[model samples]
Target chain A: MICGRTPDELIRDIEGFHGFVAPGLVIGAFMVDLAREHIGQNTEADAVVETRHCLPDAVQILTPCTVGNGWLKIADLDKFALTLYDRHTFAGFRVWLDLNKAKAHPNVYNWFMGLVSKKDLPKEILIPAIFDAGRDILSVKPVTVRAEFAKREKKSKIAVCPACNEAYAAAQGTPCLACQGKDYYHTGS
Target chain B: MICGRTPDELIRDIEGFHGFVAPGLVIGAFMVDLAREHIGQNTEADAVVETRHCLPDAVQILTPCTVGNGWLKIADLDKFALTLYDRHTFAGFRVWLDLNKAKAHPNVYNWFMGLVSKKDLPKEILIPAIFDAGRDILSVKPVTVRAEFAKREKKSKIAVCPACNEAYAAAQGTPCLACQGKDYYHTGS
Candidate 1:
């Protein structure tokens, strides 16, 4: 069971949290389970997810770490892996799917290698393959978070933006980021 | 209306998607509405969210850009701002709360300024303040996305990690990121 939930329970949670049951979410459950096992189950943890995909939802569902709480960080490195570390000590485990090991499971290997697109690879088959392979396809390792990452950032001084007069982190400098041109909306017709 | 949804509809969507109606999500609705209005309603777009907070959900709900689709880029600058740009030309708009404008609405100013913590700030008062102020509190500006950000990235060649035998982005080098030391799990006893 991942996150102390039965397969049925986990599926319901995923459907509710992610709006669907994704393959990455299933695999991520195993990855998270392995990491939590190596670390003490009850340890307060911070998570760094390596992709912007389904894995982030898995971490959010199974642990206290979440994007909103700032306990979870999305590195978006495009790797399907995650690290769960102690909040205070910065010690943790990095877990990822071992591609070589996956070779033993043809269905998983095909999906992981992207030899077949998800549309072509039937979910009925893929989901079972994922469950059959489970944690057998993962690799876990001990790691100490780098010093820079370990340091907790103090809240920045709030300043009024001269341009829009909005409050913003003063560290971003002058007139605020939107006014400085790192913005996304354009009102000029 | 935000995303063509009435306030009640938007709130229901927020509850379903985020499991709650966060104050930021409510404010984000107005921010997105103002951007979409300026950028044209039907334009194909990409988004860059400046925070990992409630604003990302607002963009996801209102626009086609989503974290899963590679269209929404989370810069996590910790600013409560977002930018929506044309997918092809990378020309777009940036929208942020105008702190000065918010000053006209006392409840919004207090909440935006964090003069009172959420625990002390009543949601009944805060929610109505956000709705009353709405698009009136936003500032929208034209922007051209930087060249580096505009370039569409090609899929990376996959390589085998020698240490864990996992398939990883070849550019990350030899043993893969986990073996290279930027890992989060600790399996060592």
Candidate 2:
């Protein structure tokens, strides 16, 4: 069994980071728990999150990784999924919120089935209920990522366009798109 | 001068897309105008917005590019800048908000100097003021991007972890970080 502080304590801490308690926060907490289980508490671990939502907050709060440090990468896949990778070893795990399995939990089922709409429901009741449901719905698995992605791209040549005076990556045979260029044509002149 | 619908009509439309009228929205509108000036209204043009704030909404409203179509790529540099790229020609323009010049406009200066905080400011005063300031502050320039970043990365090998049953990219000699990994170490064993 996954062990930690009480669910109430976790939710309270999560609430402090996130403005208010909601289903997403609960789900995020559960996801972090699973990630910690698989990866251990390695400060050097990096995170690749699929969506730009509550899950990233959970990762930032519960894990050692963060966006400021460039350890957390947002893939913006628009899915509620994340991958925790070890930079040195390249070992990682991808965790996804399995909607179907999530629905198996009573609270999640009600939320999905429309028994409880998000707007009308009180968070006090909803927060803990989602926490209970999260265990059944989350899927955690292992994988590896390319070394190239972990390494940040080197800065490319940047130039200012004389006409419009904006900065852009310098490229051969390409004129500034702003002042003198057609939509489909590649020739600079 | 940018010729288009009346300023009232434009502001009304912009207000509709963005929930509230603020300096960012006005800046976004001006940025869109600059983008349109450089690159004609071609449906194939894509946009790379540097920040995840109001500028994106402006690009989405005024230009042919959008996030849904996968044409709007967000660089998330956290700067008040944007780049509009023509997919066919690979030409682009970078636009930045010039705070010094923008402050030349009275309203913009007030907002920047913290005389007018965003929260309590009324839309009627705030909207037009920002539009005026944006005209003064925004700088348009030209640039070119490498072909590699323009083209999306091809789908790589994705594998499911046997231990936890989550999907991950397959890399040689790297175990799943979830099952076995330490913090901050670089080598995968």
Candidate 3:
């Protein structure tokens, strides 16, 4: 074949094909379908695939050299780190696949990715070693929660959405009782 | 979204697709493009895509898991047996891209595919992989080769159709022949 670049180059290029592959599972497909529902195409296996709007940010698998960093950096990619183990080897591409699936979960993908950082590995070889032992697909799930979250009081006990802390609403009870007592009149007090 | 089938049914039905997340790089894109190309809606990506038509016998990756063997198989997808390196992974997918490119340049892609197949972990992996890897819309060129063939018999030396491998005739001996011993024929054979 009249190739203009090396095979290595081709492999790397494929990794750069962005805005194409989706990360969500069934929900992802539903979203894709929803996004394209009006278009009315994409019905067959070979339909013109229209990407979903505003889903999880894309992720990238770093090369082998950067793998030793232990914990992966959660950044613009909006990713999470995860682990996978099967009957056979521990090291292989399976690690990346598992992390990828998790990242798509929204609830857990990012949460788990936060846990596994450089601190987890002593040798920092876990990442590369796994990718190095390449398997077709990662056939494992995310890490299990060892300890259950403690039950806490709810909005019924006290209304929240306090003033100033727009990110989190305060529990309501005292004062104006509009925004968890954070009314403008009660704000200064 | 109001999906046609229940989530459980969708999970059990679609061949590949997890809940809402998509997996793999370019795989989904490739399938989407394939659907479009087949239906004649593929347009925009044509500038970057280098495609060719090929008729290959469809092969299966997994089977009944009983007495009957699978129709096709691809050795582990990694480039090497040591670790799960992204650089080493996806060998099976690469073969498909190679095959489509080969089909375009009938004389060349095949010979080139054969060259790389020699180094593959297991010889058997080549067939299934070459099919599974599928076609590619290369962002750029990745390979080029120079082949020099030396033919012994004059009757066999012909200008053949590179796409279809059809043979044709050229000039007769002495009238256009520069030498008495060496000659070239134009034959589809």
Candidate 2 residue spans exceeding 4 A from truth: A1-189, B1-18, B113-116, B119-123, B171-189
A1-189 per-residue lDDT for model 1 (tens digits) = 888999889889877666677888999998999999988888888888887777877887787665654677776456888888888888889888877788899888888787888788899899889989999988888876665765556657778887766777888878888678765444443
Scored by CA lDDT, what does every candidate get?
A: 0.78, 0.61, 0.22
Which residues of candidate 3, in runs, are more than 4 Å off? Answer: A1-23, A41-189, B1-189
TM-score of chain B of each: 0.94, 0.72, 0.20
The ten-residue window of minimal lDDT in model 3 chain B covers B52-61
DockQ leader: 1
Quality class of the docking in candidate 3, CAPRI style: incorrect
Please give the range of 10 consecutive residues that has the lowest summed lDDT in model 2 chain A: A180-189
Once model 1 is optimally superposed onto the true structure by TM-score, how far is the C-alpha of residue B96 displaced, in angstroms?
A: 1.5
Tens digits of per-residue lDDT, candidate 3, A59-79, equal 111111011111111111111
lDDT of 2 by residue, B93-162 (tens): 7778775576577666565444675566666676667755655787776766557656754433444456
Report each candidate's C-alpha RMSD, comma-separated, in the order given.
4.3, 12.7, 32.2
Docking quality band of candidate 1, CAPRI definitions: acceptable
